[model samples]
Target: MTPRLALADMAATVSSEDLSNLQLLLKAPSKDAVRDVCLQSHRAPSRRLAEATAATLGVPVSQAAELVRSLHVLSHHVLFYNLSSPEQILALFPESFHSSLKNLITKILLENSPTWRTEAVSDQISLPQLKDLDWRVDMVTGSDSVSRMSVPTCLVQLQMEDPCPTAGGESVSTVTVELSRESLDTILDGLGRIRDQLSVVAGK
Candidate 1:
């Protein structure tokens, strides 16, 4: 029951003052909203602005930063379709914004990812506030690092340093993510019918 679509839902709640800002943030070639807030206040990179924004949004400053970051990804089709992960979505939102949806979101990520084959995470996190797990995912890929949310502090991460791709003879490089044995077992009865599971999730 987590916020099904973070951007759509949040966009609706944005106040009139920030409505234009939200438009700019969501517009093509997304701009940094939080940074804009900082510049407008004549305090670039000030922690206070983040804190203030976080307070207003009822989220952590870190999550606020994530919202700005996601805007960039959502604007760019490549990044949005390729790297946007469930962890990133969950991070930019508080627990109240989402119910027990991390598991569902994790599965959705696996279904949509082109990289999970390379990135695998097996870290133990403990967060009571988070309905799912207490973790913070800071993905360190081949080079580009992106996205964040309140989703407790425990992160569900998928890190891939460098995965040699087998796409044709072009020597493509890609970073993929995968849930560990422990995490999968928590939600799945068995991996034998993963396709079937995905079908259910995809509404097929």
Candidate 2:
């Protein structure tokens, strides 16, 4: 199965903690909680929510800075929504977080597409980690780029980049990623942990 399909399967089996954390992170009003969510979300991007959380909790700007740093560390492995097509990825996240989802989709498309040498000289190639989502784009000359884009729950845009370029004076041939329900579940589980952590911060 494709990674996205696997993720969908895993998302189906989310635990109470995952659901609770997700809700709390999205709705809570604590700066620390917001920061925790941001960090856990894998730097997935929730600008509006982050700002609101910071304001509600009266968190100092310096503390917010530190929180952002912590979030970076947490997000390293988090599956950003932008790693696939926006329409497909948004379907996976809760509808309430559509804004965040859109941002995630954009991020993946713009930032995550891979770059590599193409068959044509002076040509480059890139592919986003769209996983199981069906997508088609007209091939272009010079640089052939494909991306797996997504919209994250945090209303952030994200895209994974994987490029396959031809030898010389050619175009990128193909690019793909394996997907499975189990793997997607694991990724969601990790994201849930971040949600839980954010809830804790919000409690304070």
Q: Give me the candidate number with maximum lDDT.
A: 2
Candidate 2 residue 57 C-alpha distance from true site, Å:
7.1
Report residue 161 deviation for candidate 2 (angstroms): 28
Residue 74 local lDDT, model 2 = 23
TM-score of each: 0.17, 0.22
Model 2: per-residue lDDT, tens digit, 35-106?
444534342345554565456546654444444433332233123222344455344356554475335433
Give the range where candidate 2 is weakest over 10 consecutive residues by summed lDDT. Answer: 115-124
Predicted structure 1, TM vs. truth: 0.17
Query: C-alpha displacement of 17 in model 2, angstroms?
Result: 5.7
lDDT value, residue 194 of candidate 2: 96
- CA lDDT of each prediction against the hidden true structure: 0.38, 0.40
State the lDDT of candidate 1 residue by residue for 1-204, as single tens digits.
221222222223323333223332222221243334323332123466557556655666776554444432322222223335666545533454324333333344445343322221111122222122223444334433243221222234333222333445433223333444456565466655786888899994
